[model samples]
Target chain A: MSLLNNIYNQLRISHKYVNRLFKERSCYISTSPIMRDLMEFFDDKKNWGATEVKTGRSWTKDDLRIKSNTDLHKLWYVLLKEKNMLYTMEHEHNDQVRLFPSPERLDKVLDSMENLEEVVRERNRAYYELETTEIGEQTHKTITGPFGLEIDYYETEHSIPKEVNAQWQKEQNTKCRPEDVKSFLLKYKEKEYLQNKKQQRRNFNHVIGLLNRFPKMDMEALKEQYPDVDIEKAKASRKYKPPLVFD
Target chain B: MRLTQILYTKIGEWSKKYANLPDRYIKRAMEQVYWRNPKGIQYRPNTVVKRKKFHFTLDRPWSAQFAETNSPGRLHPKVFVEPIKKWSFFRGDRVEVLVGKDKEKQGIVKYIVQERNWILVEGLNCKLTKLDRGGVKIYIQEEQPLLVTDQVALVDPSDLKSTGFEWRYTQSGEQVRVSLRTGRIIPVPASAEETRDYKAKGLYVEQPKDTSEKDLGEVTFEPTLKTFEMEIMDQMGIKEDRIPKKSYWY
Candidate 1:
């Protein structure tokens, strides 16, 4: 049924010359030995029992995107099987207390798997947008925290409502109360004011120090550094002069 | 505070970039702002809340999110077939024999001959075939074949490994033996120096920390697609596995 569906979908595609398309171009495999060999990417007899098996980097998104959807789906399973094989081999190698040759092959397979998934997802998203009103599955929502901070709440399915769900209620009810909020506001404002005052003093003293240290300072750069500070007025101050005489 | 400031600047730049974008970009930006939970901003009510129809039942059990306390029945039994990523060989229980008027030969299965349903044997007597430029398929006619005729038997390649198989990392000399049927490692693989380094870097390394509510709260900070996908998992009622926590990029 699924194979028929795939064929039907292929036939439904918009092409200028439909009759010219070859039957082989469609999704069908006549079960051949050489083709099976192509599917199995392991070492031949000579290479078997050998410690290490070398492999190349994974297929990137750009490479995958150029292929047809049917090919991509087939490739997904190939990559998936490859990853599982590598993992099993690596796992066995570890148990035997021997080195698993070409461990990076596993990493490459994993990378290819990731890239393939991304490509599939990109296609899925495009297809979903083209046909449906939604973007396949991802969702988001706003939720208010206990501290009255409004946070986006991602909607999730739950057997029980938020009011009845004991675990979720604990998190929701833990929010700060009005009394706690007022006290938090007071301290938060005080902290901010103190921070600004300290910063102002630091900037003021730094300008004076710059003037004292570099008497012939680059006035333009100084102005760029502390735009609010009056460099000329700061230079005129007694604190601006160097402590020791150059002579 | 510096980090927050930098994040704000980055977000501001992103918002500016999509200021004139069509509906899709605006929607994506809005979703990002919501999920990221940016500080010091009131939640906007301008967007529509898209509700999804989700069916979740506690009785069904979620395999992905919540760990199953018991082994799943044979219906969903985890098959520990050989993973195909690394170099692996299935030691066949029985060997197949190939015979003909020209020659007869046999060999051990170093690997699965998926295409021809044929196995490549170790010590087999056979006539080699050669193709010529004259469009004639020719076999190298040798008076003698390599091996004897008794070298044939149909073996279940799957059944040979009751003792299980071993995976060897050829580069690092690390070996792991796991049961092909059960997927359980009889002798767990030893951690290598590079594996230790990966653990230190927090890549897919298991944490030995005590599992608690505080530990569970750490879920909020995890930047994995699974974090969000867990919502779907919750809907599926699939119990999660208690595998060692390792860093996985979404």
Candidate 2:
């Protein structure tokens, strides 16, 4: 019993010692010889493996717009680094099967980045607009697709000229719709047309029924409601021959 | 209502007198004929004149066609762009913390938060956190804000005092930082020293070069925030719109 107890103590110490070794190595490797920029990606050493992390609000376009291009430029990097750091930490945590702290911090950084991009785009547009009397945003055009559907095609610069470039030519060759697509579109349109006709017929008959039952009904209002229905013809028809009594 | 119904029925019968017999049912017969024999054309019904369209969304909006003509794409963005041109302080530059417990304490500029306008100078401002490592508890110090850009100022290279700078044009049209008090031509930061094109922002080489070259290309100077402020109102004077829409954010 005493020997068994001694073995258990030895096993426990070894386990604790392994744990200490891991903790020591991680702490030393992560903490030692760090620079300022490294600080941007790393949470405070205390926040490492923390269950929660507190943060402030994301950057808004208006607030960002007020900042100098230089400041905005700087902020972009800080947020970017923070994002990479969070992504890495989260990935590591996920790998280790540990809970990642406040994921909203990542969201906050992303939101700020999106807003920053939007603001930068706005600035680019404004600068371009001022310099050259154009909105400077990428222009889009409506083009007829192979399926004969109108599609918006945004114009972009290509390094290879269309006529000379075999790849571009091959891609552009998708001008005519395939037979199956045409067939699919045809049947799809037929279905759509039938659905429309069904509704129209229903509306027409509904008008006749309405007129038959409501003989003293406001015909002008009824005609206004169902413009397609011929009220006088319905009245002359056999369906409208005998007015039904309202019980 | 009764009078209108009577009028409608009378008009309905009278309309047959005015029109040909076949015209009234022509549309209905056409729909039946088209339905019985499915053809190359679809949506043959009267109301279906225009074609429906499909808009294709690119699988990647930020790539393929999304790349700009001049640049490959937007900055990879994970890396912080060292503020060389726009912000006055550069990492490794000696600076004095203007605010907080570390006020007036001079230290080497370390990390900077460009957008939030925060800075962390080495050993200048420290926040204490109690941490537990395994079974051992220890105190950890986090170096963060002395607030940032406005919170600190570059220590004058001459006297090691805080100083402001203005841009001066060199003979070669390069812009250089002119220290306000001493009229010293403080070298343009290594980060800001590059030409305006692609090299404007990035990581600074760990060691700052000795104060040998300090001028910036005219193109490197970014448009100031104030240039956009009261944009319509310039040194030429404020031009009020004949009618202010008041539609813009201040």
lDDT of 2 by residue, A1-247 (tens): 9999999999999999999998887776553245454565666677887776655345667667666565566667777777888888888788999887766567667778988888777777777677787776678877665565556666666655566668766765665547766886788789879977776666566666666544555466566656666767776767664475666
- Candidate DockQ values, in order, are 0.01, 0.01
- Evaluate residue A10 in candidate 2 and report its C-alpha lDDT on the 0 to 100 scale: 100
- Local distance difference test values of all predictions, in order: 0.45, 0.56
- Model 1 bad stretches (over 4 Å): A1-52, A142-152, A158-247, B1-250
Report the alpha-carbon TM-score of model 1 versus the true structure: 0.30
**Model 1, B71-123: lDDT tens per residue?**
22212332111112222222332344545442233334332321112233444
Judged by whole-model lDDT over C-alpha atoms, candidate 1 comes out at 0.45
Q: For candidate 2, lDDT tens digit of each residue in B1-250?
A: 2232222222122112112222223222222121243444233323333111111111111122322311322233221111122445555667788777888899975554443335568887788998889989999887866544356777678877888777788899988777898988777445333321223334223222111123221123346434332442554387766974433110
Top TM-score prediction, candidate number: 2
Candidate 2 docking: what grade? incorrect
| Clash total of candidate 2 | 3
Q: How well does candidate 2 match the true structure in TM-score terms?
A: 0.33
